[model samples]
Target chain A: EPEVTQTPSHQVTQMGQEVILRCVPISNHLYFYWYRQILGQKVEFLVSFYNNEISEKSEIFDDQFSVERPDGSNFTLKIRSTKLEDSAMYFCASRLQGSEGYTFGSGTRLTVV
Target chain B: QQPVQSPQAVILREGEDAVINCSSSKALYSVHWYRQKHGEAPVFLMILLKGGEQKGHDKISASFNEKKQQSSLYLTASQLSYSGTYFCGTGPSGGSYIPTFGRGTSLIVHP
Candidate 1:
């Protein structure tokens, strides 16, 4: 089975620093999404991307956050001036055109000190 | 908007059965079920697109209401491996594929 891959399984950064989380979605999947889980809390939607542009975004995705498919295979989320509250497990997910089911990456645990 | 999941947590013994319910205030286009183990990504279980549809995988099954506003997941003859958090994601009828997930239902099955 094909899998979505996320890099830097765990990252710890200074509160005010900028960090980027990377992901490689399924090869044939067209819709990409970013979500976050705060510890044992609910999974929160961040943004959705398609056709090299953002299709939808939640209030959680503010000006300090951005997502990009820098290359055909790489999807990245960049957060600037990170705050302590930014610490969470960030997940990347993708699905094919028909939207049968979503495949999620293992997730990157981001911690701001 | 987010869906509401019932019985935030459950404890079951091997060979027992359990049902987790998810409800939404808005009409739904599809319902997706996923299971997540500790410190791991959520694993997709099933997706129900049509209203009044029911599907199962192994001993696990799920059903979507005719109104498309609610869904229920059933676990039969549970095993130890069935222990994890179950999430129900809902997508209101539209062109977008983004799904809003419910909080989650924690299941602990012991042998």
Candidate 2:
């Protein structure tokens, strides 16, 4: 089975610093998404990307958060200024259609201190 | 709005069966199911679209009731490997919509 690859499986950064989480979705998948799971919490949607632009985003994806498909293959989530509350496991997912199930990446465990 | 999952957690022995239910206040076009092991990302289990469809695979199955805005996941003859947190995600329409998930139902199977 094809896997969504995520880099820096675990990342530790100082509070107030910047962080970028990277992901490479399935080659043919058309829709990509970013989600976060706080420790012992429900998974929360961050943003969805399609057709090279953002299709939808949640309130959690505020002014400090931005997503981009820098190239044709790489999808990235950038946090302008990290906060202690920003620590969580960030997962990148992709699917062939809007109504289909998602293939989630292994996730990047972000830790801010 | 976020969906609701019943039996926040369940404990079962191998060969036993279990059921987890998810309900939403708003009508839904599709329902998605996922399972997440501790410290791992959520893995896709299955999806049930409108028309009150039901699907199953490998002793695991799910049902979607679009009119009632509810979905259920059933695990039959469970195995230890079936232990995980199950989540149900719902989409408002068939279009490109962001799916939201419930808090999740934790299942622990023992031998």
Total clashing residue pairs per candidate?
0, 0
lDDT of 1 by residue, A1-113 (tens): 89999999999999999999999999989999999999999888899899999989988999999999988999999998899999999999998864577899999999999
Tens digits of per-residue lDDT for model 1, B27-106: 88789999999999999999998899999989999999957489999999999999999999998634455778999999
DockQ of 2: 0.82
Q: Rate the local accuracy (lDDT) of all candidates.
A: 0.92, 0.93
Return the top candidate by TM-score.
Answer: 2
Q: Per-residue lDDT for A1-113 in model 2, tens only?
A: 99999988999999999999999999999999999999999999999999999988888999999999988999999999999999999999999998789999999999999
Q: lDDT score, residue B47, model 2? A: 87
Per-candidate TM vs. native?
Answer: 0.96, 0.97
On a 0 to 100 scale, what is the lDDT of residue A10 in model 1?
A: 99
lDDT of 2: 0.93
- Residue pairs in clash, model 2: none
